[model samples]
Target: MIEIRGLTKSFHKHKVLDQIDLTIRKGDIVAVIGSSGAGKSTLLRSINLLEVPDAGTIRLDQLQVDFARKTKADVLELRKSTAMVFQQFNLFRQKTALENVMEGLIVVRKVPKEEARKIAARHLAGVGLSDRMHHYPKQLSGGQQQRVGIARALAMQPKILLFDEPTSALDPELVGEVLDTIRKAAEAGNTMLLVSHEMSFVRKVATRVLFLDQGVIVEDGTPEEVFSRPKSERTKQFLANYYRDQEPEFTI
Candidate 1:
């Protein structure tokens, strides 16, 4: 299980997160939904020490870290236990898809070249990129490139996976492929925390949903609960605005 308490971050005196607390069970796919600048991405980044929160305690299973007093080793251990996929596919321009996926394994994990190659190839195929393995990032479509990012994260075999608007950069036609890959990972029982604006996708794939607004999680429950019977006015307004074009029920 993953537990977060008193998570707080500020930027030039502007509080982006305020004492955020939540728990994610093992193998759960929890989607964080909110407006822009709602602290969703910061929360995910904080988990891996990317944003360096001003105050918080992060506990992943038995390992724990206090953000205020985290050591270098603690940061390293936190990163080793989690992997993040960004909104933009951050593959190296100089590397092929296969190399991009294998880079972490060979460099960070220090796996033998042959072993890393095999592991990378398997994950690339898992994301339906076996045919694009030898292609450079520039040669792949946005969806294909993001799939490589997913393959790279999965190849790490981290205890938890964090996705920050994974499909936000893709075109409408390309979004489905990346979402499908995430769904496959969810089916395979990967623990995931996702920040996404795709309500339909979240309703379909997320085991739990969090509605964050203005630096706080206003609602947390099963997808059905939050989407169907949200208890917070902020959540209701957000969802209503997000799904204004849909049916009155917003039952995607």
Candidate 2:
């Protein structure tokens, strides 16, 4: 389980997150939705200690994050428990898909190279990239590269997975394939915290949804509740523009 309390973060003099509190149970798929600059991505990164919270407590299972006394070792351990996947596929150019996935296990976890290869192959297959294991990032399409990224995270066996706009960088036609891979991961009961603009995907997979505006959570509820009958005016306006292009008219 992941628990966060009194989370706050700032950049220079500008506040990006303000006294945020949330709890995510194991195997829950929680989606954070908002307009640009709403601090959704910052909040996800903060959970993994990628962005230090100015004041907050983050606990993942037995591990605790002390933002006040955050050390390099603390950050490393937190990162191991929480793997992050970005919008841009950040695969090493020189490494093959399999090698890319195996890198963390071999380097960080100190697994034997052979054992890491086996694990990497299994994760790649899980993401439907087994056939492309030998391909380099440059040789694969955008969606395939993102699949390798997913495999790399899975190879770490993280307790929590954080996705920051995973499909934002993909072509429209390729977005479905990447989201489909994530849907499978969700079905497998991984604890996921996703920052995404894909409302349909959120509606389909999120056990809970958070709507943020101006660095604070304005709405928090089950996906059905938030999407169908939002309580806050901020949330209603946000969804109004968000579902503007969709058919059937988003309504309660």
Candidate 3:
């Protein structure tokens, strides 16, 4: 389980997150949805400390960290518990798909080269990239590259998987493949926190939904609950605008 309380962040004088509180049960696939600059990405990034918050307490299972007074070891422990799959498919330009996945095990986890190779190959295959394992990022399609990124994150065996607009940087045609990979991860019972603009997929894959506006999570519930009967007017407006071209219901 994960618990966060009084989570806050600011840049210059602008508060991006304001005393946010949230919880995620183990194996829950929670999707964070909102318009631009709604603290969606920042929330995911903050859990792993990519964008450090000014104040908060983040608890993952038995581990907890106070952002206001986190030690270096605390930061490292927090980072170790979560792995992020970024929007841009952050792979090593110089490495092949297998190498990209293996690097973390070999470098950070201190696994032997041969052992890391085996582990990486298994994860690559899990993401349906076995044939592309030897290919460099430049040689793979955007979707395939992102799959490799998924494999890399999965191989770490972190407590939670954080996805920050994993398909936003991909071509429209390629988005499905990455989303499929994430679906497979969910099927395999991996806990995940995702920030996505793909509302349709969010409804399909997410067990829970969070709608953030300004700096707060205005609505939180099952996908069906939030999408079908949002209590907050802002959430209803956002969804209505998103699915304006479709049916009155959230078919898309």
Q: What is the C-alpha lDDT profile of model 3 across 113-202, one tens digit per residue?
A: 999999999999998988998999999999999999999999999999999999999999999999999999999999999999999999
Which order, best to worst by lDDT?
1, 3, 2
Q: Candidate 1 residues 1-252, lDDT tens each? A: 999999999999899999999989999999999999999999999999989999989999889999999999999999989999999988999999999999999988999999999999999999998899999999999999999999999999988999999999999999999999999999999999999989999999999999998899999999999999999998889888877857675456
Give per-model TM-scores. 0.96, 0.96, 0.96
Q: What are the per-residue Cα lDDT tens digits for candidate 2 across 65-175?
A: 778887898889899898988899899999999999999999999999999999999999999988999999999999999999988987898899999999999999999
Please give the RMSD to the true structure for each candidate, in Å. Answer: 2.4, 2.4, 2.3
lDDT of each: 0.94, 0.92, 0.94
Candidate 2 has a TM-score of 0.96
Error of 3 at 67 (Å): 0.3
Backbone clashes counted, model 1: 0
